[model samples]
Target: MGERPVRRSDELVELLERYAKEDGTRETEIPGLRFIRASRITEPVHSVYEPSLCVVAQGSKEVLLGEERYQYDPASYLTASVYLPITGQIMEASPDAPYLSVQLQLDMNQILEVIQAAEQAGKPKHESGRGLVVSRLGDSLLEAVLRLVRLLDTPEDIPVLAAGFIREIIYRVLQDEQNAAMKQFALLGSRAQRIAKVIERMNREFAQPLKVEELAEEARMSASSLYSYFREVTGMSPIQYQKQLRLQEARRLLLSEGLGAADAAYQVGYESPSHFSREYTRKFGLPPGRDLQRLRETLGR
Candidate 1:
């Protein structure tokens, strides 16, 4: 058989390894970009993935959004236009050839700004779809991504050029064949916009118990319609969304502050410590104390 077509992914992977820092840690200075290098695959961990795009230059990953699973590799890109609770695991990583990737955080204000500009330019109306999507990678998109990542080497130029590069990336995404999904984020009165508002509110007050009626009213949709649309966009119910927000915060408190189980639970809005322990175990596959202990051990290793 003829030799398989050579993939540029390997080249990009090598560049990332030379430039990227360790995985699972956010770089201090960058507000909207993160580079990761992981020695081994990670367990599914919970977090609220905000609007963003993730490109895997080297390895692959699987994300669980509610019951739905999304897998993306070098040949594809993943986008989320609203806040979502997700469990993500690196499916392709190792010590010799670690997983390398960059995450570009999305800014709603910037998205809106682009939307207005596009509308003024008479961009065609876009159809609606799920709030999250994975699209096959394209050469132009990859080139833009590479340029954005490469800018890190010249720190002084970053402040001046980063915003323009980000805009270029977002513009490239808007011009893609599958642009409709991302376009929904820019439409002010669109169903996606309403849902995004609710997502923002949920993130802001995640510890408080949420009321579906209140949320529906805020979204200006009937309760049933809100339920259907929210699930259609986010793949989870309102209550489930709030629960995830709560759990993620509790985990953060436990891991970062070294808070005890009861204190962490109470701080995260759980009324009964026993109930918190049970739910935490169910969600993370271990009770708080043991789960944290295991995390510490893993870090040590």
Candidate 2:
């Protein structure tokens, strides 16, 4: 496929235009399904990605995880198999066409049930521990997605048909040749799953000092293996991951809670305001107060 899809993208554009019809993200009657519309290119926005499928109907996007970048448009779809801190920007959009996309969140139960019933007991392909991947949107997957989106117009039929369509979509994704990353995380005791637990623990306790040995013991991996696989799946070391979580939370505190810089720093486990300010500036390209002002102005519009 090329930069623009012809028939499929047209249908999606029509549905999204009617359903969303707004400038920001719109939640649908269907749980975990959302539509996003943007009239222009955007600055980088940071957020944690839950397990979900993301597809664009009329634009392209770039998602940054650690130092890795995943680019997708109408020709491809992206899946996040686990929770990940990511930065995303709309690379292509304008008042003429606008950027339109849909996201459907999924859980472990869905993936596990589908893979188990399919009897795909084989181990994931080697070196497929990454938590994020972009796969070409083949006909089968695209058709299934279209069916799921169509349910928005007939909420009456959704109760009976949505689950089946959702399962069918997952099944199609699992059948992909490069679905190893998704499979690894869904399979029990897989390295990726173990690392996922570590992520959960770290996210829950980001304010707590990182203990590599403790995380290693919990994941049943040596500190060395833990470091390697953690990077393999998350694209960063455990400490680096925790730092991002803390910084992101600190930023949120400053923005939403009206917390001062020092208060926010200590709340997120920073011992020194100066150190926190330095790291904050390094990561976000501004000091705390300046960034807060900038964010406020951005959101005010």
Best by lDDT: 2
| Tens digit per residue, CA lDDT, model 2, 1-301 | 6433467778898999888888899998877899999999999998888889998998899999999999999889999888898989999999889899999998778898998899975875574477888999887788788899999889999889999999998999888777777877877787888888888888899999899999999989899999999998889888888888899999999998999999999999999999999999999999999999999998893
Runs with alpha carbons beyond 4 Å of true place in candidate 1: 1-11, 26-30, 120-128
Candidate 1 vs. truth: CA RMSD? 3.0
The runs of at least 3 residues in candidate 2 whose Cα sits more than 4 Å from the true structure, single-residue gaps closed, are 1-5
lDDT of 2 at 45: 90
**Candidates' TM-scores?**
0.89, 0.96
Q: Candidate 2 at 60: error in angstroms?
A: 0.8
Report every candidate's CA lDDT. 0.80, 0.89
Give the CA lDDT, 0 to 100, for residue 47 in model 1. Answer: 78
Instruction: lDDT for model 2, please.
Output: 0.89
